[model samples]
Target: MTDATTTTAEAETAARPWLDASLPVAERVELLLAEMTVEEKAGLLFQTMITMGEDGELAEADPVFGLPSNREFVLEKGMTHFNLLGVAPTAGAIARWHNKLQELAASTRLGIPVTISTDPRHSFTENPGAAMLAGPFSQWPDALGLAATRDAALVERFGDIARQEYTAVGIRVALHPQVDLATEPRWSRVLQTFGEDAELSGELGAAYIRGFQNGDAFGAESVSTMVKHFPGGGPQKDGEDPHFAYGREQVYPGGQFELHLKPFAAAFDAGVRQVMPYYGMPVDTEYEEVGFGFNKSVLTGLLRERFEFDGIVCTDWGLVNDAAIFGQPFPARAWGVEHLTPLERVEKILDAGADQFGGEACPELVLELVAQGRVDEQRLDVSVRRLLREKFALGLFENPFVDAEAADAIVGSAEFRAAGDAAQRASIAVLSNRDAVLPFTPGVKLYVEGIAPEVAAAYGEVVDSPADADLAVLRLQAPFEQRATMFENFFHAGSLEFSGDVVAHVAEVAAAVPTVVDVFLDRPAILGPVVEAASAVAGNWGASAAALLDVLSGAAPAGGRLPFDIPSSMAAVEASRPDVPFDTADPLFRFGHGLTL
Candidate 1:
C-alpha cells in the first residue's frame, strides 16, 4: 500500500468513534461540515471514474487534477466523491479500492467519506453499446423489460436486489430509475427508459425509488435514488434522440409532454434525492429553447417551482467542454445558447440552479469561476450543504466500508437470478394472433428464423433458416439511425422502409410457410408490408420478444397495449408538428390498441 492508503486506513480506524448515530443528525452534519474546506467541499460535487490500467493496477495521473492519478496532489489537495469506473475482476479488489479511497478521504481533517455513485450495472445484457457492463454487479433485465412485466412488486424487488449489490460494493448512490416515458420509439436511449404510458410509468417508477431507498427512513445502506430527466424525455422531434446535434429538439404536439411529466412527479413524491435534466431542447414549451441542462425556466422555474422539487439537480454529460475522450475534443453543451463559452456555460448552469455538473471531469473551470467571483461562494455552499446532508442521510459517514464477503453471496445469487428470469417471463407481449395461429399443437414441425436457435428449439424441430421452416418466425428491429459509409455520425434521416431485399425475403418465407412476425419496437417502424404478408404480427417495446414467443407457444397470455401510435409512414412522422410525439395525421396502430386470445 502507498503512504496515502496507509494514512487513510489509520485515519478511518481512528474516526470510527465520531460516526456514532447516538449524536443528533444536525450536530453530526454540522461537525462534518465545519471540517471541510472550500476546495474539499467543491471536490465532493465532482465525480470521476477510477479505471484499472492494462497492467491490472490503478492508473496514475497528476495529483493536481484530483483524478485517479497524481496521488500526492489528491492527498494534499483533498478531493472526495469518485464515480468508481471500470469494473474490477473481483469483489475483493473493488472493496480494497473503495476502502483505500475512503481511507484517503478520512485522512483529511474532515474525513468526509467519498460517496461513490454508479449507473445501472445489474442488467442481463451489459449494453456495451449504451451503458456499462455488469461485470461485477448482479445481472437483471433492462428497464424496458421490467416495465413489460407490469408488476410493481417485481420492479421494487429488482430495485431491492440492485441496492443490495450496489451497497455491497460501497456504491451509495444510484444515478437511475430513468422514469422517462419511451414515447418516441426511435430514440436510441429508449431501451433504458420505462414504456410510454404515463400513469403506469409513474407508479412503477415510484416503486423503483421506494425499493432502492427502502423504508429504512434512516439507514446508511439505503441507496439514494436519482430520478432523472426531470420533466420527461419522450417527445424527440422526428423520432430523433437528443445525443446527436440534429436530434436535440423535443417536440410536444399531442399535449403528451404533460403526460410524460407524471412519472417524474411520482419519483419526486417518493423522496428521490437527485434529478438529472435531459440533453434535449424543448422547442414547443415556454421554457428556454435550449436543452434542459442549460434552461433555467425548466430546471429552476418548472421542476423546482411548479413541482416543488427540492433535490440536487445535475446536468447531463457533454454540457461543458475542456475534457477530451478518444482524441476527439467535445464542445460544451451550448445546444440552444450557441454563443456561451465554456466558462459562460458553467455560470449559466449554476445560475439556473443546478447543483452538480455531470459527465464533466474537470473541476478547474468550476474553481476558476469561484475564484473569479463570477459564481457566488454562498451558492456553492448551498449545494455542498445539501450534498453533505445526503451523504449523512445515506449513512455513508457511519459505515463507509462495504462487507466484501457479502458481495459475491448477494450478487447474481440464485434468488436474484430467479427473480430476473421471472421478470423476463412476465414482460413479453403478444400483440396479434389472427385465427388462433398461436399455441402450436405438440408434434407440429415448427420452422423458425431470426430467433436464437436455443430459443427456437424449445418449441419443436428447429429449421436451418427461413426457407426450411414449417412456420416462418421472422424477428425484426425498428429502423435505426443510418450512417453513411459506416463512418459518418448516425443521424436520423432515414425512412422506416426496410430494404426491398429484406421485404422480399420475408415475403418469400411467408409464401413457403405460415408466418408469424415479431418486431422489437425500439422505435415504431412502418410495418405495412410485414403486417400485410404475415399471418400474425406482434410488437413490443424492449423485452416483449421472449414474451411474444411465450404467448405464441401458449405458455403465457398476451397483454400489452401500444404505448404510442405506430405512424403509417415516414411522411406522417416528418409532416407532423415538431412539438407533439405520436401526433401523426393517421396511425397504422393507435395507442392502447392490442389483441389477445
Candidate 2:
C-alpha cells in the first residue's frame, strides 16, 4: 500500500473509529466511550424488559406493567439495553421486530446498537417475571430435566441450538443458566435449576455456557450468557423466593454457603460474560444483610476481589424503584437498604460494583447523582467502557440487523422440535414400576386424567373410568401451598406435601386397577403415599402428553434419573437444613434413583 492510500484509510478510521471493524475492540471501546454524552452513558447503565408492538412494530406503551413506549425508552431516555418480554406468532415476527428496534437504535447519536436479552424461553414455564413459554421456539424440558439426563454433551447441544435460534431473531444476551442449587425443597425457582448436587450443576452449567457463547469465544454468532444469582439464590428461608417482600431472608442453617457457590464457580470458569445477583438478602452470614444487588461486601469483595470476575455485574430486577407487577403494586426489593431513597439506591448499586441496573430505566437519577457529586462521571465511564466493549466484541456495531426470513426456518425447525421431543421422552424418570407392569401391552383399556384422551387413544383403548380399564394413568403437579396474591400464586412456594383430596383421588384410581402416576417435579414432593398407591410412578419436567406416552408404551427408552431427592414426608423436609443438599432423611426416592424399562 502507498503512503497516500494508508493516510486516506487512517483519516477514514479517525472520522469514525468506533465503526471501524479493523480496529481492536479495546481501541474501539475507548473511541466510543470518549464520544458518548453523559446521558448516553447513563442510558448504558439500565437494562429493563421491552415488549413488542402489535404485528411486530415498536410497542407504544404497556399500561399493564407501567412501561413507557419504546420510543420514549430509546429516543427520550436514551436506554440501549433491553430484556425482551413476551413472544410473537412466528420467529419471523420476532426477527423483523428486532431489526426495527435496531434501526431505532441506529438513529441514536452514537448509533450504539441495543443489546437485547431474554429470560429462559425455550421451556414450558410462562412466569411473566422469570421465564416465557416456548411459543415459536423449539420446546425443551426444563433445566432440571437436562440435569436428569446427566449428559453434559446434550446440554451443550441444547445451548448451541438455542443460540442459533436466539441470534436468528437478533437476541444477543441470555439472562440465564440459573446455577443456584435446589437444596431447599420449597424454593419457588428450583425447576429452572439443576438439582441439589453442586458438582452436577457446575458441570451442566459450564456446558450450558459453552453452548450459548459458542465454546468460550464470543462473537457475532454468540448469545452472551449472564450466569445469575451469584453466591447462590437457594437456601431461601422457608423456601420462599426473595421476589416478594415477605421472602427476603436467605438463610444457611448448615453453614453450607460455600457449597451453594460451586456452580457459579464453574460458570465463571466457562467464560460467562455477565452476572446477576439475586434479590435475596443474606441472613446471619458474614456478609451484610442487604440484597446481593446492594451488598458491596459480597459483590465487590467476594465476587470482584476474591473470585476476580471483571465482567458485567447486573442486579436482579426492581432494586432501586417500586413497580407494579400484573397490575398490582409492589415495593422495590431494597431489602436491608429500603430506608434509602431511589437516588441513594442507585448510588449504592454503583458503589457495590454492578455495571447495569436490571429491570429499571432511571437515567435521570444517574445524571442527578453526577451533578450532586455523589457519583463521578469517571465511574459512569468505567461501566460505559465495559458495556461498549461487549457490543463491539459481539460485532453489533458492524451489523445489528439479522436475516428476518431465515429466522422462520431456523427457529422451531422440524429437526429442532424432534430433538426437543426426544429430550422430553428421555427425561421421564420411572420412580416405581411395581410387578414389572410398565411396558404396557398395546390396546389395553386405559383411563386417564391430565393426559388428553385424543392423545392417549394412539397407545391404547381410552376408557371412561379406572373400573372399566386394564390400566390407568394420571398426571399430577407436585403440591404447593397457594398464596394469597395473584402474582404470588405464580410462584409455587410453601408446602411440598399434596392435599388430602389429591391423595384420596389417587388412591381411588389405584384401587380399581394397576395405575401409573406421573408427577411434574417442579419442586420435589413428599411422594411416599403416591408411590405406595400406584403400580408405577414417573417424574417429568415439561414433557408433552405424547412424549410421556412414547416412553411408557415402549416406543422410546426411559432414561431419566431423579435430579433431586423425593422426601418420604413433610416432616423430613422441615427437619433438613435449608442449605444442605440431599439432607432430608429417608427420602421416598434418592437422588439418581430411577427404574429402567
Best by lDDT: 2
Off by over 4 Å in 2: 1-14
Instruction: Give the per-residue lDDT of model 2 (tens digit) for 535-556.
Output: 9999998899999988898898
Question: Can you give the TM-score per candidate against the true fold?
Answer: 0.87, 0.97
- In candidate 1, what are the lDDT values of residues 1-597, reduced to their tens digit? 999997886676456534656777666666666666667766666655555333233457634333446244246545565556656666656666666667767677667777778777776432343456777565565777677667788889888888887777788888788877766555666667776677877888888988898845636768888887767877778666666666778888776667778888888788888898988888867778987988889888988899887778878766877544434444555688768888888888888888887766566777888899888777887778777778878887767887667777766678876676566556555565666677665445667666776776677777766566667677776665465422123333346666777778778888888888887665567887778778788775444345446767777766655656777877786777543545676888876666764
Please state the error at residue 579 of candidate 2 in Å: 0.8
User: Deviation in angstroms for 19 in model 1?
Assistant: 3.0
lDDT of each: 0.70, 0.91
Colliding pairs, model 2: none
Distance (Å) between predicted and true CA of 256, model 1? 5.5
